[model samples]
Target chain A: MLTPEHIRDFLDEVKDPEIPVLSLNDLGVITGIEVAEDGFVTVRMTPTFAGCPAMEYMRAEVEQSLKRHGVQAFTVQMSFSEPWNSNKISEKGRKALKEFGLAPPQPYQGILVLDILEYAECPNCHSTNTEMRTPFGPTLCRSMHFCLNCRQLFEQFKPL
Target chain B: MLENAIKDLLYKIADDQLILGHRNSEWTGFGPMLEEDIAFSSMAQDKLGHSLAFYTLLHQMGEGDPDTVAFMRNADQFHNSQLVELPIGEYDFSLIRHFLYDNAEILRFESLSQSTNEEIAKIATKLKGEVRYHVLHANTLVKQLGSATQESISRLQQSLEYALPFALGIFEPSKHEQELIDAGIYSGEAALQNQWLERISAVLEKTHLKLPEIANLQPVYGGRYGQHTEHLQPLLDEMAEVFKIDPTAEW
Candidate 1:
């Protein structure tokens, strides 16, 4: 008698392997869910990046979560037709990212401008007085920033 | 004939991505700044993933499994361009190579997105979006550093000159080039090279750096046919070091 809502609720407990604080639902990676009368469940997902190493781990976690919820046959399907963008990240996810010591993604403006440093508030001190250390970060979606106020170096999830 | 041609094209593309992705990943802990570290790592992951996708296609076409093909290949068996296997010397050198290589790669992916081969075209379409950011990152840095201070500009110029010959080798024609072109699987290295030249020239024009007169320059070829610099075998050895230990043990 498990419904799609119950499956979604179960998935909400599945945290992103890289950013453990954010659930897959919070990150907007889970695109769709279906529950069949025969207790089969299907989840459609998209990766934050085409090559995100965490993807396989996340898929396993999704299946584990659903199976734990007593679903008999389930499948997790990865889709790329829609393409992923940072804009898909929820507001709650942004707040979680900030609280976790990484600056959240800013609103993406069309065409990357070099001046994005001006708006990167420090996750450590919440100060706008930050300098960009590098436009590229340790991961595809992150950038390095230095807070002049707190003197702490932090990573920012760059807006896509 | 077309099958061999297609496999040749896929192997070269996959090998290039795999080797260069490994090189980019080497910057993880050593970037001058954390953002660059992450940027390279991000691009590295994307490149590696792209290689995996192509390898998967090869597997479907009856090649060996992806893990065996990627981790167990000898240096002579690899088909990556020599440019990718070169050591990442300095930020200047890596950045210049990034600019040169990605310009060509983005163009290649764009053309491949329209390939008559549906599978290749689909993968290309998915991958091209990811590479767009890599191109942006490369072009932005090249423009900034290529025109900035005396030190930065001079360093970039030096690296550009040193990397150019190897970069040109990326366009070394495949023996199956005509077959690939005629089959609409790819438009051929010559066409891609021409497009790459225009693209890189457009970016370089915005900077103080000058493009070397490529007409007189001899490309460092042979990589397409498996001849590599001494640097490559060592790199391959290092890559296989951990994988060879257990081949079956999952981390």
Candidate 2:
């Protein structure tokens, strides 16, 4: 009696190739998972950023994870039907991002105002006294920030 | 007819992104500062990805594959505006162009997110989120430098004036504009232009820079119908050089 939950558990083993610390499930990119009675498994994913080079690699990881779990006749699709925003990152994912020394995005409602982007809490010292240095960073989903309190320059998982 | 209209719309937008993305890449190691260097490079990567998304949609609609369509097209075959194809001149000009171009782009995607075409809507929704950061970056720099030292302010002002007419070219009307608007696939270019003007004006107002009276300026047009500056063809050649060497070879 394999369920989508079981499939999800298998996917939990797959981590973001870039972040490494965050699992696909906790990243909230595993948009939909279904296991048909005929044993056809369908896994859907959305990219954290449309330009993320790691998406194709992540899709391949999903397929390999499913295969390792002994599942056959599966289709892994990438789409924007559900689109990815920082809010989609699970509480566990936020914890993982913080633990990785990256500031987790603050949850926001409605439109993402510019103020939210200008502000980031320091991951090292837990200080909100930080200024965004640049919106673009080494990767698509990150922004550079400087913390005045701890005098450290860090990256944040940018709030979309 | 509706499909053709949609394809026409996609082509212009895709071409704009691809050309500007390439221009942004030219700044990879040449930026005035290290942070700006990374910023432009990262933005180049993002725009290239965005162009690929639109090209993929066009392929799904029965066009050639993304690489073929992007790499094989000639200057006269492209539908991008004259604004994007211009060389990234000085850093001030590049920054001003970025500020003007991205402001309009954000508004375009915002409207397109509500498009009746489901696929276009979905892609727009996803892209608009990423573009917010671009707009933020542009506005932030424009404000800071626009109000900075005398040399910086004057340089930015001159660039803004030089880039304005060309920026207006971004909204050149499509031949099937009416049809697309009627089909709800797109909001018409005129409406988009008006919104763009208002938005850019608001941002400029925040700075010491003056918004020139664009009402009297002659816009550089015809890029929508494949008319481009002398700069576009060489750019295409350089961009396609490696791809032409071995089109069949796989990475």
Candidate 3:
């Protein structure tokens, strides 16, 4: 019989596909989990959006992670009542993302936020003059920019 | 269609999205599970964004800026169909609303793609991508919930009883409905309604749910006409408090 601690350990290892440095729990995406008396587990998660492309993969990962801990008959439930925001992302997750070569989101204030967006500072060269001619970037999250210094095209996550 | 009439058309479409998006945003963090909470929140945000884009086009046409288009306008100027304004009753009702609106929007964008108005066509091109995802998500829920346990089916049935009339409001014609159709900017309201019903009926059939004998509510035309529901007033009050305080304040 697997313990909840074992379950936690297994889940801790599943990294977010986009930001591989942080676990989903650290991202604050895994909002709730219930371990029933009979070992039936239900995981509650809010996606970044209703139409988020990552949902199927994330759900499967959660199920497989728990099953590895010997929990079966699990259900994954989704809700939109409270809405997910960048605010839900943990400071630790943000730090992890920055450390992993992705820029973490800048905090939101009522006014005067000097957030990244004049040009995405290049990940490779850390140049500030990179500009994206195209709004739709390489991926949904990141836009492709040409580093004037390096002359190499790279991707940066776009602000919402 | 006359430019003014197109502006009214634009307002109806954008307002429906803005109000519905706001209502859906209310569900964030309160869902039965966490993943759904995030998914719903994302959808709400997308709707707000899409509305902003559409309203920006109107602002360029001299109607109002995005913020004013959304928050400052009186309810009578909104012109949103009633479907987008009604309070969400329950999860099933919410799902039903999605089932109706998502597909309708997909069709609306498709029609707009061939619009005579260049700006409208260009905007429709971008919206197609987002609306397609909404259709897929809503359809997936309709199927899953239909095939779900008895409790889910019962709740969905109950949801249908209240939501169908409001859902029908998606087709409530605005003043420019015929002009839009004549100008090849969009299909007429009746045609959209028929297609909406057929699509909605097909999905509901799979859910093993009973369709309520609903009288399509005479849509209260406040959203398109800028005569909004009571809910909208407070919502505007909350969202626009900052912008209202200083029109020059940059968000």
Candidate 4:
């Protein structure tokens, strides 16, 4: 029987577009997958932000993945009430982004409302010499920035 | 002004803000700088939050539930302008549009803050604070990118020129324009558009970019009439899918 574990295993190979090295499962885009007795799989997802551009394709890709595995009557449900933030991604996803040359979002600086960190430390060298290039990034989920020291371009995972 | 007219105008404003907020929210985690990522996302949240405030006024006025007023309304019913409904573009385009839109919004909100209508004045005053930050942030980006190398200037100009006409649509007239003007609810379209152009040009001139031919640009009808571009449908579907499935379900 193909259990939820099987589904998880399958998604492990799927990479998040923004952070290409991290699997969607690692990033927690696939929050939960329920396999019904009738062979229907209901995959629950939450976008880091409600308007993430990758979501539409992510939904379709999940649907196709299950169909390929011979699961019938599947649906991808995207939820928003609880909302998604950096905390949603697992420990594995954090490590993956860091190693993959992307900076994972730092934990809340104990401030309830806003974290007042001025600049991000570069993923390439961990230098705090990064300056923001664009408030909006190549995609909706990321912002554009370049590291001053290395002169290398990189994307920072935004705080929720 | 007329209550019915005010209701319609508010919806237009609310819908534009909400839809743009939704579109920009997509950039939350994916921006280039961690700080900027949060900034862009925060702006999106502000847009949506402002929309909600306006929608609540609508709900109280007997329009409908706030969520339903926002989510359940079909494509034809939303009154946001063409500029907001377009898909999220490259960073330069988004930055340019933000610079243009926020300045206009600040000016518009300032006028709204003074409306003879208590409700409009109250909401506008409340929103005035965040609107100021939005303009400041955009102005900084405009200054930086405007002074940046050739590549940045080209990208920003392309978006600025391309979207200029649709951008004008933000100041498009409501069906009851004169009533709103005579009653002191708003300054009306002609005054607002001229102000928008003057402000937009003044900022763009600081950059090395050419101002889009102001006199030739024409407004598109999307926001008031609820006709949006191709980009809005997928966004609406994703954002509304859950709520649409069960409007009454709390989630």
Candidate 5:
């Protein structure tokens, strides 16, 4: 009999299709796990955004991971009710994101301000002397920054 | 009758999102700054996702699959506004257009959230939150750049004037507009535009930019009836380029 702990362990290996560096658990997308009396498993999750394209792939990957572990019946249920926040990302995920060359998200203060430049340390040189290039980066969660010390351009995962 | 009106409404909204999303994605890796590159790409993904949602609704109504409908449509077949199909010119132009378009879009989604059709209403309600952020992003940039240096202010002012005529096309009334309004599917584009003007003017009031005289300028219409600028065909060609080559391939 596969325990819920075993299922969680299996899911921890399922990385996000977009980021790839962080697992679903690391990103805090996995909200609930239910094992029915009839041996059916239900995994509840929420997307980082309502229209995140990677969501379909994430659902499929979860089902595949559970099946690979010899689970006979499983389903991935998606919900937008709880909604996702950047604060859900684990400390391990933040370190991994930084190591992967993408600045991790900071805690948002609920005000729309361009002050991320003041606190965004350059992932390349660890220098605080950086300037924001644009608040609108290549993706919804990122913003661009320039390091004055290293003269390297980098993307900061915007605090949401 | 209601079905036809609903489909028409869905097509225009979906087409606008798909085309603008493609345009926004082009900014990826080429943004003046990494943050902007990411921002455009992020909004691009959101726009694409929103289009997919609407297309899925159409698919459920017996249209072709979302991929086929989105990837196979030609420029003449698309129903987007002329404003979204224009090439994202300079940063100032893109920013100004974003300001104008998203203002109307947020209002559109808010109105649609009350749609009599349950599915459309649910989708709109969920999407309204995302569009709110887009409006926030556009408003913030417009405010900052609008009042910044003389160069920035002048550039934005020029782009604002250039974009207004086309922006009006977003409210070009559909043929079935009356049916849609009667059925309570949407409140119609005219009402949406009135609300949009007030909302956009409020933001412009805080900036150095000025709103153009709408009564004097001719609105560029015909996109809803399938006529489009020459720019749209090339954009469609580029968008379907890869999809056409291997429509069966999964990657």
Candidate 6:
């Protein structure tokens, strides 16, 4: 009776290690979930940044989430077959990021330009009057910006 | 033979990233400004991650695990271009090296994204996006400083001149260069160098910095075949220090 949807539903409880408000499912890193006739499950995930230190932790958390859901005989794998871009973050993920005080990335086309890095809607004031301070941030997935309207420094989930 | 060529290409690129990542880390707390500190540190983390991806690919190609291959190797065994192994001298030098180095790196990854090898292609596709930010940072700073005060412009120009020869060495071809190119594994280093030249020239043109006559300079070769400056061994020693303390230690 267990379906991939059921597996996905169970994974909804697992949040990103760095951004706790965002679930792994909403974060768009859970690339695939499969349930076999033999009652084995396989989960595939990819990193937002290949060097993301949180990836191993996230992978382990996926395994733990499955075990806690009373599922056994599961395997978790990380790959780049479906690489991550900021566009992968679900709308729910974007909402959670904004509510968490991080500016959500602007939906970008397939090509990312320097202009995209400059456009951060201020999470505090919802202001478009912002300037990017630096592309590299405290985390590889975020960039620093300052909002002229809010007069506050903020971080944006960098659009990859 | 084709496999050797591919592995050789992968090793050099991975080593360049790993070594330069370490050098960048040295600026973690030492950058002239806090933004710069965060920038270099973030770049270090990204580069380290990039190196791990390539090392993982090399592992899949039957090399040792990423840890063993990265830590257990001697300086003489590394294949990074000499440009990456040099000491991070001053801010000017580091900035110039970063500008020169990443400009070529971005082009290399862009070209490799179309590689006939699917796995390499996948990694190249994923990484080129991340590296784009590095290029943006480098170009912005290079243009700003290359046109700033007299001292800033002169220092950057001096660093640029000092770094050019080694920058050219990044294109040192392996014996299998032709084989790799002909097989569609890679497009060859010569073509990459030409593209790199155009890209860097375009950036420098926006600033006061002058591009030296590269044709007149002898390229400093040998790092691809394990010839490194005296700086590399010390870097390797420091990098492997903790790992060597207990090779079996787990985090």
The most accurate candidate by TM-score is: 6
| Predicted structure with the largest DockQ when compared to the true one | 6
lDDT of 6 by residue, B1-251 (tens): 89999999999999999999999999989999999999889889889999999999999999999999999999999999999989999999999999999999998899889999999999999999999999999999998998899999999999999999999999998889999999898789999999999999999999999999988999999999989999999999999998999988876
lDDT of 6: 0.92
What digit string (tens of lDDT, one per residue) describes model 4 on residues A1-160?
A: 6689998988887777666788788777777888888778878886655445567677777777777877778788865423455656788888887787667766664432322222566888888778866544555445556899999988777544
Worst-scoring 10-residue span by lDDT in model 1 chain B: B124-133
TM-score of each: 0.85, 0.97, 0.60, 0.62, 0.78, 0.98
Tens digit of lDDT per residue, candidate 5, span B98-150?
88999999899989989999888877876765776678779989999999999
Distance (Å) between predicted and true CA of A109, model 1?
Answer: 9.2
Residue B4 in candidate 5 has what lDDT?
Answer: 80
RMSD of 3: 20.7
Question: How high is the DockQ of candidate 4?
Answer: 0.04
The per-residue C-alpha lDDT of model 6 at residue A8 equals 99
Greater lDDT among 1 and 2 belongs to 2
- Assign candidate 4 its CAPRI class: incorrect
Displacement of the residue A29 alpha carbon in candidate 6, Å: 0.6
lDDT string for model 3 (B17-128, tens) is 8888887787887866654555566678778867876787888798757876676766555667666766766777887787878888878877887788888876776566
Higher-TM-score candidate among 2 and 6? 6
- Please list the residue runs of candidate 3 whose C-alpha ends up more than 4 Å from where it truly belongs after superposition: A1-160, B213-223, B246-251
Error of 1 at B126 (Å): 3.3
What does candidate 2's lDDT look like per residue over B74-107, in tens digits?
Answer: 9999999999999999999999999889989988
User: By DockQ thresholds, what CAPRI class is model 3?
Assistant: incorrect
Candidate 5 stretches greater than 4 Å from native = A1-46, A50-53, A74-139, A142-160
Tens digits of per-residue lDDT, candidate 5, A19-127, equal: 8999999988898888888889988987776667688899899999988888888888876545566778999999999999988876665543446433577899888
Q: Per-prediction RMSD in angstroms?
A: 3.4, 1.3, 20.7, 11.5, 4.4, 1.0
Q: After superposition, how far is residue B180 of candidate 5 from its true place, in Å?
A: 2.8
Using DockQ, rank the candidates from best to worst. 6, 2, 1, 5, 4, 3
Candidate 5 lDDT: 0.85
The candidates, ranked best first by TM-score, are 6, 2, 1, 5, 4, 3
Q: Once model 3 is optimally superposed onto the true structure by TM-score, how far is the C-alpha of residue A42 displaced, in angstroms?
A: 53
